[model samples]
Structure formats: C-alpha cells, structure tokens
Target: MNAAIHEFTAERLAGGDQSIGAYAGKVLLIVNTASNCGFTPQYEGLEALYQRYRERGLEVLGFPCNQFGSQEPGEADEIASFCQKNYGVSFPMFAKIEVNGDDTHPLYRYLKKAAPGLLGSESIKWNFTKFLVNRQGEVTARYASATSPEAIAGDIEKLL
Candidate 1:
C-alpha cells in the first residue's frame, strides 16, 4: 500500500513541529491557502465546514503557500493573524510552504502524487487546491481551487 498522509510532518504556523500522524483516523481536508488570492474568502466556508463537521471526525488543515502570485507573502505570525481576524479560522494552519516547484513541501508532494489534477497533472495550479483524505489516510479525492468547501461537505459527510 502507498504511504499514508499521517506519515508526513509539517511545521505549525505558531512555531513547532507537527506530525500529520496526530490526525490519524480523522477525515482530512488539506488545503493550500493564500491571504491575498481571489479565493481567499473561501476561508469562511472552510471554517464553517470545520465547525460543522469537526465533531464528526473532520479535520481541516490549512497550509499557507506563496508559490502562486506571491499571494501569501506574510510571515508565519502575519498569516496566522490574518486567518483568525478575517475569517475567524480556528482550524490548524501550517507555516508557509511551496505547493509547486523544486522546494514543494513533502506532504504536498505526496498529496499531488496520490491525487493528480486534470489531465493527470501532478503540479498544483493555484492556491486553495484541496485534497480530501479518508480516515484510513487514503486520498479519496482532489478538488481544484475553484471547488468550494461547501460543495465538499457531502463527501466529507460520507467519509464520516
């Protein structure tokens, strides 16, 4: 079997190492985010999903990325502050990481490989791209940047 997402580790925006394994057995909505993107407002919908389904095993993880248009050019503190103040985001947010190119974060590298995008492309096209993983750590689906969090609610419900 392929490696589970729980096998990866990333730094928390608040400044500490975090093992993805800590979220094992939880349904995950892993998203690449940016502060100034056109889709930035989706944070509200994401938070709504987290609030609505967290008790049912859903865990939304946000990873700030500046690889696209330099939209998330803030330091970890600024990024965390923006998310909380603007969208009241309480879901876990990770430190800035690349979602594409040479320095792509290892977690993202695994996600893209497991759920390649349109035309089987492994590279992420834009920020807010999401990967939904089931409790077993299997990547069940990949959602494009345009896919709203609300639209993924049913899928998450099924997993739960």
Candidate 2:
C-alpha cells in the first residue's frame, strides 16, 4: 500500500487530471457525494466548513459517486452546475467515480484501507461517506453518511 494520500490522483470535475500531491500539507475532508441523495444538502455545511477553515489549510474535496442507488446520474458539467447553483459550492469537486466494485477509484481504495468503517468493513456503504486526512496525508478518521459536516469542525480544528 502507498504510504500517503499524495500518491494518488483524480480527475477534476471541470477538466483535467489533478495530482493529489498538490494538496500536500493541507488537511483534507474527502467525501463521496451525490446529487440526488438525502445527504446532498450537506454541500452547504461542507462549503461552510471550507470557508471557515480554508485559509487555515482545510480543503473539502467532493467526489461525486453513483454506486449508491444511482443517486448521481449527471455528467460532470451538470453536476458542477447543480452544486454551484443550488449550494454555491466552491470547494474542489471531482468527476463522478465509482466508490465500490471493481472500478473503485484508487484514492477511495486507499482511504477505505487506511480507515475501515464499522466492524472493519472497507467497502463504502453509501453516498456522503467522509474520510478525514491530516496535513501529513495520513488518513485519520472516517465519518458515516449521516454524520453532518458541521459535526466534524472540532476534529478539523485540531488538525489545523
């Protein structure tokens, strides 16, 4: 297994592939998001956290996923537009990627192994599942779909 998250890369929602290494030394809240899920509203809370702690080095990275209930069915453009218009999301958003099964993104694969879910399960259960990584690129914690972004502020504060 890779030693740190900086070893991975993902496609940006807008265009082009981005190296995760670019975010080295910055705390990351990586989340598997969806456009039609109940947790979709969490975008606002996530943006709030980003705005609050961004200058302090906190980055909320949103990765759209369709593995759960096919909740995210739009193309990259649609997803980007929806996030901006509905929630005014300004954080980095990535192209839709599979969170489970054979096609799971490498970044997610590392995250699951670094911080398994309840009962040591590595499979992501659903959309909006979050993984917190420290500035050193170490996977620190994993939050469930129901856990609100606001609830993670205290944890983020410590890392910052």
Query: All candidates' TM-scores?
Result: 0.97, 0.98
Off by over 4 Å in 1: 1-3
For model 2, state the Cα shift of residue 106 in Å: 0.6
Residue pairs that clash (backbone atoms under 3 angstroms), model 2: none
Instruction: Score candidate 1 by TM-score against the native.
Output: 0.97
lDDT of 1 by residue, 1-160 (tens): 2346888999999989999999988999999999999999999999999999999999999999998999999999899889999999999999999988999999999999999999999999999999999999999999999999999999999999
- Candidate 2 yields a Cα-based lDDT of 0.94
Give lDDT: candidate 1, residue 85.
97
Candidate 1 clashes between residue pairs 3 or more apart in a chain or in different chains: none
User: Each candidate's lDDT (Cα)?
Assistant: 0.94, 0.94
For candidate 2, report its TM-score: 0.98
Over 1-160, each residue of candidate 2 has an lDDT whose tens digit, in order, gives: 2346898889999989998999998999999999999999999999999999999999999999988999999999999999999999999999999888899898999899999999999999999999999988899999999999999999999999
